[model samples]
Target chain A: MIHTEQLTKVYPGTDFAAVDCLDLEVGTGEIFGLLGPNGAGKTTTAGMLTTRVIPTSGRALVGGVDVAAQPALAKQVSGIVSQQNTLDRQLNVWENLYFHGRLFGMGATTSRRIADELLEQFQLEKWAQASVYALSGGMAQRLMVARAIFHRPAVLFLDEPTAGLDPQSRLALWEVLGQLNRDGQTIMLTTHYMEEADRLCHRVAIMDHGKILALDTPAALKRGIGADTIVTVRAAADPEQLAAVLARDVAGVERARVADGAVQLDVSGGQRLVQQIVLAAERAGADILDLSITEPTLETVFITLTGRELRD
Target chain B: MAASDVTGDVTTRAVPARIELQLRPVLTASYSALGALLLRDLVVLWKDKWVFVLRTVIQPFLLCFVFLYVFPKIGQGVGGGGGRRGESSFATVLVPGVVGISIMFQGVQSIALNMAQEFGFTREIEDRVQAPCPIWLVAMAKVLSGAAQGALSAVLVLPIAAVVHAAGVHAHLDLRWWIILTLVPLACIAMAGLGLVLGTSFEPRNIGLMFGFIILPITFLGGTYYGWTTLSPVRIGGFHWLQVLVLINPLMYVNEGMRAAFTSSPHMHLYVIYPVMAAFATTFLAIGLRNFRRRVLA
Candidate 1:
């Protein structure tokens, strides 16, 4: 488990704190996500918790040991897959894992067995003897994860683990993470990928500008958006006119607005609202090009809370 | 999975014994991790065997070949033309100096240059420091492995430097087994400690300046071509200023130690060489470890 009390970090030569008064707790066996865009202080928060970056103020505890006070012990209990590829270029895949295991004080036989299991699990057995320089981005990332957990750490901190992978590799890594979580690892990761956070995290903290705007289960956060469904309609008419028509005619429509050349409506009865919008557009002699109804998503919740898109 | 499944009560013994039990594992882990770190560097060096061979041998070989062989053959041998005895004595002095310089360069190249890359834009030091040991111990690991490489370079360069000479220009090595056994290692470690200081003090981009400003001067004035005792003649008034000034160079101590090890030449006394080399080693390591910890934290 990981806990922090107002953990903070202000890097030198910068006025703004990278992590500000962050009070966070991650329960054992929970897959927690720190969701944010670039420069959102997610990596900095992860750094402090992992004891890589000493906090400017406040405190963090990992596996019941104060990270600042007993950094080596904290490091022993937690594994970190850094945002950047920090794999040893001089080492082959097997050497990287074996050395990590050795560093954690595993016996040679235990280290070898774990390295073999991880290489197989991550589908990197073929490259076990291959130099890290020879690996592709996805393979290297997988190796980083494999090396991190080679010690059977109590807490795992993954800083943007899927940043540069292709879709297939990203999904593969998601399954790997999910399997780890299911096996009872306390996993925490920082990510800007909305879908990754939604699909993978048990609980997510939506972060921006060194502060958490919202934290909850993805489903709860989405449902907390205050609307039953979202109705989006793209038409030949001006989107503002479509919005006006939806607002005027739709009975259960809570809000209507134009965005990205489309009229979007927050409504209670989505099916009925979609039908009403089509009829109104036809009556106004506007050709409807597209229309769809959607449930509120984590993204919509994020936008509702932050007044900006997740990537903004 | 339930939280309790992963968070079962970690067993503890009685108070004093429990503390010992915890400390014991940490100490053993540090020991094993240090060995693994050293092994990793050695394995990489082994893998790049040809590169290692070229780097270890070529510079020393050329220095010996030109100074001991070509110069004598071309009738421009050092210490004036005092005939075969002069060239032979010069060879004796130059051989250990070649060995000394090799160790120094090995230390710097293996540790300082490598550290620059690790700490540069690559950020490779992050992975290294991730080892479950005190951060200072991690830096100590680098110094130890670098010392090993420096010692290896001393061994590798010695034979090539000893025999690659013109006719009648062979180094008259009066090898004291005790000195060779003791002094060479001490000198290697001292130079490697110097490497650690240079590695951590300078940024990667400034490494070129390190060689230009520090390494080159250390090599030239480090008593490589001349014995430290011989510098007594190059005086400012009645004072041996050149000899005193070169005393500040760590490699001077290493070269003096090497001369004591490999020859019967009138070198700086062992009484001075031993303690001074130890002092230099301790001083460099202390500063280097402090700088290392600071850089890693930063």
Candidate 2:
């Protein structure tokens, strides 16, 4: 549904490219996530494909149309939900969808019918006549998604779709996106939320410094670390020093490093690993302030690849 | 593992992607999209029609009320200073002048002010420009809608301006239908095109600079308070610098066109007004569309 070949974008007066030689393909019927922190080139990549950002060099195609060369055609095939609230405040909720239909060439009767259906489908029927201002954030987001798909775009691109939502709203959006995908809509989303990438995306590309460091499914990525347990520690001493000590002392410790002001280690041991980590901290004279063990996540995969946290 | 880990993940969902719609050619699609964009603007205007009427009438009404009615009643008539005849003649000139100013102000308020909020306030333009059309066409829609509002303001303000005078002081209005029908639309489009330029040129927060530098100067010097022929006396040694300088203002052509349409007042010759007004409209719309494309794209 989407393809990019060495797509690069170097903004004027910048020392480096915002997106550097990104070669990517998003197939039909897939929930693909570009997982990265701020300044990681995710949004820039999406912008290039959407024709909002002109690439410095290389080509991006959406459903066989070159985005830069034929942006209007690209727009016909791809629907976008920007990171900001972009609903028209002047129009009521129904008019927002109605006008969207009109702009896409639907007749007035057809526009009204579709607008009613979308309002009902997105559970916004109660607020159909109300001003958009009256909606809560979650409801507004649902309306945005409904408007996006009203034209039945081939691929839907969402940039940080759930960045500032409350937990319930975020979960609701995840479900909404998941439902759309199941109904045969190709979806691509960019997010810094590791859990969102892990739970929602079928495949995720971890990016930093404008390059993809790793790309795989969440399970495969977690298993690729080759660790059964992940132990995070906060110590009184320097975290890097404590990480060094634990990496050497722990028996099944495959690797260790400091991320987000804490020491983290990937180990292969069983249930006794926590006790062994405690013993190692005591022996190294490290006053461990906090310690926890959990299974590896997409975040651990990112840390293993880049030596940094996903939220950094 | 922690308690949160136990409730860790949700089931993932995926399905095949399918899209089936017979899209028309690019130009056809853009044409309807452009019409729809204008319709959206019209619907918004309709919803606030009462406020629109009030906004269109208030300024022109007050100008007529103060200049034609109150000033003549208080014996402080402008340009005449005394008799009912002189005051009545001033009213005739002022009537069309107020209509011209109304068209100009309506265009600016509708296009430029709304653009400031859309571009800067909430990024509301994000969804607007995403419509299935070329970016410049989106801008043309705004110009078209603003022009519609300007024309409507002209219709609303003319009668109000012509009749609001003191008793026994009546202004003669010789309605040249040819000029009125052609020149009013031309004046509207030209001014709305200027609205597009000013709208795209000014940033949202610094919009005060738009009025301070562009609007106020256009209003005071664009021959709205007097006819263009009257500016011939304010010259230096046969230079006619003031007359030539006001020619640079697009509103001068609009007001001059209005004078030719509404009253038998002396104005810039018909030969100079139409083509120059058309040229101004074309030039402003071109620059405005360019600025709009630049703003929306990057």
Candidate 3:
């Protein structure tokens, strides 16, 4: 389990805090996700909890050891898979896991046996003797995960776990993480991939600018958008004004705002919705260039909350 | 501990029982992790033992062959001395110097050069530091392994001194047991510490600058071809600036100590050599460990 109380980090020479007054808790058996775009302080949050980056203020406890105060002990309890392929380049595939086991105080025979088992479980036994350079990107990532968990850490922390992988590899990593969680690993990961969060995390916290705007199960978060459908209208100009006018005047429209150069509306139900939309746009002296309707998703929820796309 | 026993504990320990951390438990863990880290490096070295031996011996071997064997036999030619007597004397200086420089090269090449890549953009040192010990201990592992390699290179290079001269161009080694036992290990530690400082001080991109500016200067002026005692003539205003300047070079102490250990050649007194070498070793390790901590954190 991981818990933090107003954990904060303001990198030196910067006036702004990267992670600000964050109070977070991750339960022992849940897969938690911090969903945000780059610089959202998601990685910084993960860094603080993992004790890689010391927090400027506040406290973080991982597996009941204060990470900032007792990093050595915290490290014993936590496993980390960073975004990069951090597999040791010098070691063969098997030695990578074997040494990790050794670093965690496992006996030589225990380390070797567990390493061999991990290689088999991760489907990397064929390359056990091969240098890490021989692995493809996905295989290398899997090997890193296998090494991280070789110590049977209490909590597993992954930072942007699948930022750069082929679709197959990404899915494969997801499956691997899912299996680990099922085996009772306390999992926490930070990612910008909405689908990854939705599919993999039991609880997802939508984060932006170092603050969580919302947190809930993905299903509950999506349902919290308070509408069944999303209608996006791109106009020639003045989309914000058009959105305000539409929100105030249109029936069944729960919320409307300008997002990604368009007026997006969350509508619960609608008859003659397109006709009403066009009439409202014209009345607001806006020319509609494009109009689209999508079923509400976590993305729609995000844009509704932040008034900007996740990538932006 | 059986694999079967651990297999079941894996499920129960997942939540980690509230992490009641006491220093004794963690200290025990740190010792095992440190031992394991060194073991990993030893295993890597053993895997490449052939290449390692070849790399370690090649430079000193050639230095001795060309200067001690070929030049002495080819008469007073390039690197040959004034005559048999001069070449023979130069052989004494060259042989121990070759051993000293070999120790320096092995330390730098093993720890610093490899560290350039480990801390490079790939940051291959990531998982290593994440071991269940203090970050400084991780660096200590590097220094220890590098020192061992330096000692190994010394051991490997010493045989060349005994065997490699032309018949008359003798090194005149005294084999002082007391000095050899104490000084050789001290020299290894000093050179390995210097390697640590260089490797951590330079970024991967500017490693060429380290070689051009730091390593080259350390090698040439490190008293390999001559003795520190012979540098009295290169003085202006009785300053002995070059001699004083090379004093700042840790390799000077190492080469001088090698002479004290191996030959009757004039060396900087062992009195100055021991404390100064220890100071250099401690200073380099302190700076290098600080730099390493800075690089690893924040």
Which candidate's DockQ is highest? 2
DockQ category of candidate 1: acceptable
Clashing pairs in 1: none
Candidate 1 positional error at B167, Å: 1.1
Which should have the higher TM-score, number 1 or number 2?
Answer: 2
Q: Write the per-residue lDDT of candidate 2 for residues B200-255, one digit (tens) a residue.
A: 99899878988898889998998888889988888899899999999998888888
lDDT of 1 at A130: 91
Give DockQ per model, in order.
0.32, 0.48, 0.45
Q: lDDT: which is higher, 1 or 2?
A: 2
- B1-298 in candidate 1: lDDT tens per residue? 4666544432221111111213235566678778878777878889988898899999999998888888888888485678888988888899999989999998899889999889886677898887877888888888888888888888899899666888777788888999988888888788888988999999999999999999999999999999988888898789999988998888898898899899898898899999999999999999999998889884
- C-alpha lDDT of residue A34 in model 1: 94
lDDT of 2 at B85: 82
Better of 1 and 3 by DockQ: 3
Per-residue accuracy of model 2 over A1-312 as CA lDDT, tens digit each:
789999999988898989999999998788999999999999999999888888999999887889999888778888889898999999999999999999998899999999998898888999999999999898888888998888888789999999889999999999999988888788999999999999999999999999998888988889889998899999888888888888887888888888888998899865578788889889888888999999999889988988877777
Superposed on all Cα atoms, model 1 deviates from the true structure by an RMSD in Å of: 4.8
What residue runs in model 2 are displaced by over 4 Å at the alpha carbon? B1-18
In model 3 chain A, the worst 10-residue window by lDDT is A82-91
Clashes of 2: 0
